[model samples]
Target: MSEAGVSLEMSKGSAPLTPVLSANWGDPRAWKLVNYERRGGYQGLRTALAMSPDEVISLVKDAGLRGRGGAGFPAGLKWSFIPKDNPNPTYLVVNCDESEPGTCKDMPLLMASPHTLVEGAIIASYAVHAKMAFLYVRGEVLHIIRRLQQAVAEAYAAGYLGTDILGSGYDLDIMVHAGAGAYICGEETALLDSLEGRRGQPRLRPPFPAVAGLYASPTVVNNAETISSVPAIVAHGKDWFQAMGTEKSAGFTLYSLSGHVARPGQYEAPLGITLHQLLDISGGMRAGHRLKFFTPGGSSTPMFSAAEIDVPLDYESVAGAGSIPGHQGPAVLRRDHLGGAHRDPLDRVLQARVLRQVHPLPGGHLVAGPDAAQDRGRRGGARRRRQDARRQRPDRRQILLHPGRRRRRMHPRRGEELPGRVRGRLPRRPGMAAAALRAQHGLRPRGLPRRGRGLLR
Candidate 1:
């Protein structure tokens, strides 16, 4: 994180470390509406009903809330963009199509606390004068969709979604719709298209989704996390919500942490938290390992090394770190898999994408070394065939026999350690197992030459 974005904020304010969105996620009955109501769930809707629509939007703005979906647009500010005078019906679309790889917060959230999202959708629709709202979930997670559907039904049964909710004279309805499982539909215009029973494709902007969306009407499309954040901001005052994070990026957010961490689960924390802090509490890396390089936000963001772990994870700080604040949370890669990460066909392909800055290739772009990049399983098959026949392809057999060589061939970027006397250690914290051998065997020069700006690949 840049000094400008977080240093002052850290030194100035006191914040809570407890998880907010995920607090009830561990409860067995969290998915039930009765249990949710018991935990003070529809209160935000009641509070919004008591106040005016404009007041709800204002509260969100004061909370300093931003979108959790790849784009970090402020939720309240985006809500305010809806024109009040339009004759067409205003709509609120809760975009649950979280198709970005490694972005898994919303699905688990719905499975655990589906009512949170349903209530949030209602409050957001009321704020924007949207009588009709839709929870556009991705088609792949059918179970999540079913949970959300049951929650919506519960809301109606409890007088939260149907006519004259809570006797507030504000009638609203929420529908749970599923998309055809296309990642591109996560885009607002494309989502609108898919929601309207059309082909999912990005629409050129001039009339953004706020002005025109589902069924060619005025609409507000927000991320599941972004809309789910609304209920909390409404239930608690803006000041209470603002008390947690940095001045510009306030409140707690659900962070999905996976890959080589002691505790790999959802962590809700104040924005601008450093990975070092997360690692400290997470038991650092799985014993005998430490973070080497990790994608700050999925594969699209820049890969950060151990030296940059102190960078704060807020929007401004991450932007300052020369990477966009990705919607998906961090995917920590440990030094234990250095050479292993590289040889793994998938890891190498993703690394190639991260390594190329200009004219980035599309999702299916191929990397170099076509022959060497042949699937490791295929090479193993060739080795087996060779053993049965003339017993040739000794190099292939060596790779199959040696775990390090096999990992280097399969998972190259994560290719780090292999079992040796020292458990395949290198000179440094995240040193290369192969490099350690080259150095130990005296193959390296007195001063190892720097190559490709410190890139092992």
Candidate 2:
């Protein structure tokens, strides 16, 4: 598991955690400029402002920084793709619309430390020679939006944003846009469409975002985490950033560990770290439970069995294992989570519907009020009289008792055919309906109460 560039020997027993973006997450009020500046924040932007844009791009390219946005495209190469001879203005768009299930690292990062993103955006824009930048965030996360807005406002006030930033004579402005909660907007072209006041949809490639994007000009759309890592690369040398991860995949990244684990949250580690190491760092799965399967990235990505738990979770390794490292968040599902030894929650919810159709409540009453119950009883008594009269008739008893000839009625609420007929071979007594249901479905009272009082009696 130990690669050439990765440093796994630093830890005594467990894997080493290199928290670059998540370094100040534990600090109190780390989102504010005061706290962030205390921890050497904006130093990267200051360093970036001193160097030429081409040099900055070369530095990132040399660092081997790949886009954290699923595709793992080279970030510096993407920046270098902008047509310098084009007459139109260049723009940078940060993709923060993390609507994918389990890809929750961006929201928390924005909530905890918005300035890191702000500084990174400034450096990224400067490197790409983009005068205007947009930080496109998920509209559903209003709190994160407000936090990011405040952080950007602080940056502008501190002379890190606007014209002549830190006396470098570089002009750049960042706008925080709130998207209307569309998952498709996570795509770069769809995001560009939404930013332009139209319905979010993907555009045809050919003239991509780098060539003609964001108002028909050259644009660079990078993931939130991808742009956030730029400040660190600029602050620290390329060699320092390259030393953490593998030869191809360099730098530390946020790995969101969720579900069935004892410690479920973002664990910022270097690339090429395996799930076994992550599990050891996170305190493993829940007590008395074992891992069954886990998604390598988000829910859309293919799931990996427990046998592949030790596969290195880098871009190449995860892809080689037949799954994308989408958002780098692994949702761990335990054996018990599959509802094998346990009653599925959906069944428990529908059990009441089964009871409503099969058995009336105590005292021959429906779930309705006493008045409705009395009315139902009157109607039921009339039906019972008719049924008894029919039972006395010759052919009725023979046909009702005949297993093959018994008629089945479809449930009114649920369009499924009930087992036999509700009035026929099925139970009529209260609480017996549950037993009959269990018998018909071959379902056990896995989640039943201690006294055998539950969804399935």
Top candidate (lDDT) = 2
**C-alpha TM-scores of all predictions:** 0.73, 0.72
Query: Could you give candidate 1's per-residue lDDT for residues 244-277 as a string of tens digits?
Result: 7777777777777777887777777788777776
Each model's lDDT:
0.69, 0.73
As for candidate 2, its clashing pairs are none
- Candidate 1 CA-lDDT value: 0.69
Error of 2 at 79 (Å): 0.4
* Candidate 1: stretches off by over 4 Å: 1-16, 336-457
Collision count of model 2: 0
Following a full C-alpha superposition, what root-mean-square deviation does model 1 have from the true structure? 16.4
Residue 385, candidate 1: C-alpha displacement in angstroms = 28
What's model 2's TM-score? Answer: 0.72
